[model samples]
Target: MYFWFLLIVKSVFHHITPVPKIALPTAQGFSFIALTDILYFKADNNEALVYYLKPYDTKTHSAVIFKRLSDIEAALHYNGFLRIRRNYLINTYNIKQVNNRAIVMANDETLYPSRDRGKVVEAYLKEHFYI
Candidate 1:
């Protein structure tokens, strides 16, 4: 019984540990983006544009990185980021409103959620609101 309790406690502690930060390369050097700060990732050809949330700013700042949106989506999915479209991976925490099939982000950007992913987004919103 003690061994089982110890194992469960260890598992909980492991899950609560902080995830590794993502390093984004820039012209100057690199920027470390925490999972909580990411607003969304937009695919632009072979590059992915990362938008980050900033306090006291109405708009989010963006940076282009040489990575695929799918790749970023996979890496950040466990951190509350969801791929709502083929070209968009958005942080669920930054969602402001849901208008029909579209989502309004905290930065006031309107993005269309994919038809197949609409239900998923709705469920997430419901869970977020504890409704």
Candidate 2:
């Protein structure tokens, strides 16, 4: 069968040929300047950094550019991340604890799930915020 032939070829090539290095030449990794996807840049002098938002790219083997942190918050809110506070957007998958007063993200980071939302954070976490 064609499938068997292809498999044999692949196996032969994989064993005989040196492992071909496949990598995204740095341009594709998460950048602080563009943290939405695969670009990361940070300003050494500035107190507040301007991060770019991108998503992952399968073809490029990198996260794709989405938008800025603010933009991401506006879009993915309650869907992929929990807005623990104005500055911290905790991926619910990263959450380790929750109580009446606060939600704990990894690295011992804790944030009050904005009491104004009442049970919105808890409810959203229950529905979305996957691991």
Candidate 3:
């Protein structure tokens, strides 16, 4: 019952509320990153490597966020992120190209999806990349 209630609340609030910026703790302080600026997240065991466009800067930067990929995905999936692989959670807007076995990101990083997710990736490519 609690799970269902939480799901309902999330669904209802997800549409009405603006997506929140993810807070990343650093040695100096905390950094709040806008979801739109994020490119992708690479899972590394218990933490994730976040690649994002720096504000007012053309270069992309990376930070190690102390959260599991699944946790990050849970917070971001509703806001244009896709779990293409077990190790990669990508922002759909930053996808440059999608091949049969690999995806090229905006910053030229290539990632591979699991074979089980091939159909979903292909569908996304067909719907968005192809005419």
Candidate 4:
């Protein structure tokens, strides 16, 4: 009963809340990419790469966004993004598979969570994916 209640509440909350979108700078202008379309964010030296699926495109595409992983995680974490590792911020909805050591994104990219965050990851997976 408790599980079903929580599931229903989550479903309702997800539908009630609008999907978040972030503007990415382009050569012409800026493009707003929906958070749901993103697979993950991999941190580079001083910037991060956003990997996402384009509308009607089967292949995943990437763009370099000028932001720190921590900053991006703070902005999107509440909207279904998780900072599994120090350098990786992943969209929970785009998770293909998760294991004790690593998480596989829809694009077949493998990311490992930090040891300190292992329990948090497990709890999240259990609550969201029943893993």
Candidate 5:
């Protein structure tokens, strides 16, 4: 069953891989972000916030876009990045530190934990990172 599932997933994503360029305001300049992990972001304006995930790079400025966060997650197979919480989806690479109430970003953007999701998020992070 697992083998069949693997085949199905491989074939499903064989042609839908992301192909875009990410331009960052950093010393590395611009890069070809072949596949980036974007988490769901919904604001009051019926839009979503998205950031590009160019792993293992030294870029700070992420491309923020308004999108249908739910739709994007379903198509991505939930593979590359972990949806830690509903409102906050971070590319683990850019996650600098996790305190009790917030996840700090490389750009010093301290995003607060979801209103009712601190304990769950903390436990998940600890288990996943062995912290």
Candidate 6:
């Protein structure tokens, strides 16, 4: 009976999808953020600024990570994150509005689409709407 119980517990745990997380260096030490907490990423000079949803409010808190935006973008590609512009990567699940030239996030932050990637952005918007 114990062997059967252990096997059942293991099987249940194995079928659960693990939460996605990223480790980022902070002033104190490091911060681990679940992907669901991420709101967007903005390109700084040589790093990426990560914006995360704050509890009990519509605002976001930010942290600077010493990683390239492209690198972060690739890491988050499979997690509903989309590179909407040359300098911005947004969480599609957090999008509140889509406009001709910009997207508004749940926190009311507006980010413009890349001029060079206009067609791609349009296609993405259409696909998202259709689903």
- Number of the top TM-score candidate: 4
lDDT of each: 0.84, 0.46, 0.85, 0.88, 0.56, 0.84
Better of 4 and 6 by lDDT: 4
Clashes of each: 0, 25, 0, 0, 0, 0
Please give the distance, in angstroms, between residue 9's alpha carbon in candidate 2 and its true position after superposition.
Answer: 18
Cα lDDT for residue 52, candidate 3: 96
Candidate 2 per-residue lDDT, tens place, 1-131, comes to 99999999999898786422112223656433222332121222222122222344233222333334565466555345455544445455556677666765443545575666647776776666441
Against the true structure, candidate 2 reaches a TM-score of 0.42
Maximum-lDDT candidate: 4
Candidate 3 lDDT tens digits, 6-58: 99999999888875688889999999998888999999999999999977887
Per-residue lDDT tens digits for candidate 4, residues 4-71, read 99999999998989767889998989988988899999999889999999878889888999999998
In candidate 2 the C-alpha lDDT for residue 22 amounts to: 16
Q: Considering TM-score, where higher is better, how would the candidates rank from best to worst? A: 4, 6, 1, 3, 5, 2
Model 3, residue 30: displacement in angstroms? 0.8
In model 4, the worst 10-residue window by lDDT is 98-107
Show where candidate 5 strays beyond 4 Å: 1-46, 52-66, 80-86
The alpha-carbon deviation from the true structure for residue 2 of candidate 4, after best TM-score superposition, in angstroms, is: 31
Cα lDDT, model 5, residue 116: 67
For candidate 1, the lDDT comes to 0.84
Clashing pairs in 4: none
Q: After superposition, how far is residue 57 of candidate 2 from its true place, in Å?
A: 25
lDDT of 1 by residue, 1-131 (tens): 99999999999999999865678897789988777777889999999999987556666789898999988887777788888888889998788888878888888889998889888878977887663
Error of 6 at 32 (Å): 1.6
